[model samples]
Target: MASRSRLHVAVFLAPAVLVYTAVMIWPLFNTLRLSLYVEADGVRSFAGLANFATLFGDPRWSEAFWNALGNNFWFFVVHMLVQNPIGVALAAILSHPRLRFAALYRSAIFIPTILSFVIVGFAWKLILSPIWGIAPGILDAVGLKALFAPWLGREEYALTTLALISVWQFVGIPMMLIYAALLSIPEEILEAGEIDGITGWSAFWRIKLPLILPSIGIISILTFVGNFNAFDLIYAAQGALAGPDFSTDILGTFLYRTFFGFQLQLGDPHMGSAIATAMFAIILAGVCIYLFAIQTRMRRYQF
Candidate 1:
């Protein structure tokens, strides 16, 4: 009977595992393999690790590589600082037992997340434009017109502004995930805490927050991966150059530019492959650290 049950489980899991391996795992392995080769004149040659060596040692490649990598890190940091906290706060409020119009609030908050990246990017651009944007006009109405500036066009503010915009659109995901985690906690647990004189903020701090640590950790890792892979928004708003002097340039856009060529620079697949490999390595290291270090230590409590 136990053998039969095991077979049943395998039967159900086999198709998903097969599809995942074929679609995701195989392509990743092939890309890693390609990263070890150099392509010239439509011919492929095994370059061992020379591609990686040049990627770090060569001046032309290293500068953009480091800059994009640094920008990506800051992008992830901004999301952690702004998006996660806002999501948690909203989730907490939404989870309140007596809250009205909860469904409507959830739908409205999540609507932006479901929109295509191109739509969100263009919409924000129009709204932030200097000539006819509503943002400056709204600020003027509120007696803060002096605060308005072409933040998207300035080198110093462009990346930060874009990061904030990305956060605004995506916070709904974390909010929903955290809210669901909160709801999964049994009412008996809250009742027990209340019975012992715990209530409000005190109850949440002592009882709820600790239990949601695992969910928060997952959200953090997801934000890290997503931020590092971000390209569409930056491309749509700032173009492939990530301009106003490439201040918003990140690894994804940089890789794209390297692969396809832009203006004076010729496209080089070998270099692009090297950059992609570096990104994959970075993401792999992060995932390993989270899984083996942080995840091993985190215990989700049962209600």
Candidate 2:
């Protein structure tokens, strides 16, 4: 009977394993292989690390690559410092026992997340348009009209503005995850804390926060992956150029522009693959750090 059960389990797993191998593992290795080769005069030849050397050493490619990478880092930072903390606060507030309309509030806050990237991008663009935008009018109403400008059209503010827009759209994800974590805490633990005179803010800080560390870690990792892989919103709003002097460009848009020839530049799959490989390396390194540094150090509390 044990042998029969084992056979059944193997059968159940086989199809999933095969699908994962075919769809994910194979394509990943293929891309990695492509990154090591170059096409010259309509012929593909193994170029070793030549492609990577050119990517880093060549002036034209290296500048754009570094620019996009830097922008991506800043993008990730904004989400980490602003979005996550705001989400945590909102989740804490909504999780209160006496809070009214909590579900309605959650759904309302989460509505933007469900909208398509195309929609959000275009909507925001229209709203922020300097010539005919409502932003100026709204600012005028609040007597802050002097602060209004074409934020998306300027090099200095474009990236930061887009990052904030992205944060506004996705804040709900962290909020929901943290909210669920907060709700999962055992009432008995809180009761004990109350008995010990640990109430309200003190109870949350000492008792609740530690238990939710794992969830926060997970949310952080997810945010890292998603922000690094982001493309659609930027493309939809700013075009392939990631304009205002390419200030809004990130790794994803850079990869796209590199992979598929943009404007006068011809497509080079080898270089595109190198960019992708680099991205894979970065994301892998982040996950490893989280797994080894953060996850291992976090003490998992049991109810």
Candidate 3:
């Protein structure tokens, strides 16, 4: 019976394991392998770390790489500072005991998350366009017309504007996660807090916040991974070039341009793989830091 049960378990797990290996593990290792090689005049050769050195040493590659890296950092920072806090605040409000139409509000807020990146990007682009957008008219109605600009066109505001649009689309994810975390808190603990004169903001700060640290940490890591891997929205909105002079260029766009070769530039798979490898390293490092430094210190509050 023990041997039969073990066989059954293996049979169940085999398909998933095979699929994961084929789709994820294989591609990842292949990309890493490609990164260690270089091509010259159609002849490929082992280059070891030469490609990486060129990526950082050559001005042509290094300038674009560093610019994309910096933009990616800022993209993540905006999501952390703006998206998570707003999500938390929305979750807190929606979780209120006597709030009316709470279900409707929750559903409405989460609507954007289900929409495609292409739709969100184009929709916002049209709405923000200076030539024929509704945003300027709306701002004019509110007596704030001067605040409006061609946000997606100008280099100064393009990256930040795109980041904000991304934030709007994905805020519901953190809201839902944090909402579930808030709901998991014991009613007895909250009641006891009330008895100790800890209600409203004080109750949230003193009693509830500590328990939800794990959820927040998870959300942060997810945001880090997603932001770093982001491509579709930027591509949809700004094209592969990521212009107005590549102001919104990020690692994903950089990889796309390198891999496929945009107008006037020849595609270089080896260099593209190098960029991918770098991105993987960055994401892995962030996850490791979060797991070791942040997650280890968080106490898992039990009911």
Candidate 4:
């Protein structure tokens, strides 16, 4: 009977494992393999770390690579600073037992997350359009038209503007994660807090917040991964070039342009794979850091 049950479990898991291996594991190894070779005279040859050297040591490639990397970090920073905090606040509010229309509020906030990136990108782009966008008209009505500018068209403002737009679209993710964490707190714990005269904000700070630390950590790591992986929305909004002069270019866009080529540039698969490997290293390091922090916290709790 135990053997049969084990077989059942394996049967259920096999498809997903196979699919993951094919789509994810295979591509990853292939990209790494491709990165090791350089094309010369219409023939590919093993170049080892030469591609990586060029990426870091060569001025032309290194400049764009570093620029995109810096921009990607800024993008992640914006989401961390602006999106996660707002989501946490919203989750706190929505989790209030007395809060009315909580379902409606939750739905409204989260609906944007399910929308296609193309739709959100185009919608925001249209709304922010300088000539015919309603943003100017609405600002004019509110006596703040002076604040309106061609944000996407300007180098200084484009990346930040797009980052904020992304924040607006995805803020609800952290909210929902935190909300579930809040809901999962044992009733007995809350009762004990109340018995100790801990109530309302005090109860939350002394009791709830401590318990939800793990969930918050998870949300932070997820945001890091998601922000690093972000491509579709930026691509839809800014194109492969990630223009106004590549100000909005992140690693994903940079990889796309390098791997697939954009306009005058020809695709260099070896260089593209090198960039992808760098991204994998970055994400892996981030995940490892999060894991280390979690383990340290757990050890402290155990002690």
lDDT of 4 at 276: 95
Best by lDDT: 3
lDDT of 1 at 3: 50
> How far is 67's C-alpha from truth in model 1 (Å)?
0.6
Task: Give the whole-model CA lDDT for all candidates, comma-separated.
Answer: 0.92, 0.94, 0.95, 0.91
Alpha-carbon runs more than 4 Å astray in model 3: 1-5
Global Cα lDDT for candidate 4: 0.91
lDDT of 4 by residue, 1-303 (tens): 555556777899999999999999999999988988999889999999999999999999899999998998999999999999899889989999999999999999999999999999999999999877999999999999999999998999999999999999999999999999889888888898899999999988888788777777888899899988899988999899999999999999999999999899999899999999999999999999889866466522221
Error of 3 at 253 (Å): 0.3
lDDT of 3 at 8: 69
Model 1 Cα lDDT, one tens digit per residue, 1-303: 555556767899999999999999998878788778888788899999988888899997788899999999999999999999999999999999899999999999989999888998999999999988999999999999999999899989999999999998999999999999999888899899999999999988988898889999999999999998999999999999999998999999999998778889888777787888899999989999999999999986755
- Candidate 3: deviation at residue 263, Å? 1.6
Cα error, residue 151 of model 1, in Å, equals 0.9
lDDT per residue as tens, model 3, 1-303? 555656767899999999999999999999999999999988999999998999999998999999999999999999999999999999999899899999999999899999999999999999999988999999999999999989999999999999999999999999999999999999999999999899989999988888888999999999999999999999999999999999999999999999889999999999999999999999999999999999998898667
Pairs clashing within candidate 4: none
Candidate 3 clashing pairs, residues 3+ apart or interchain: none
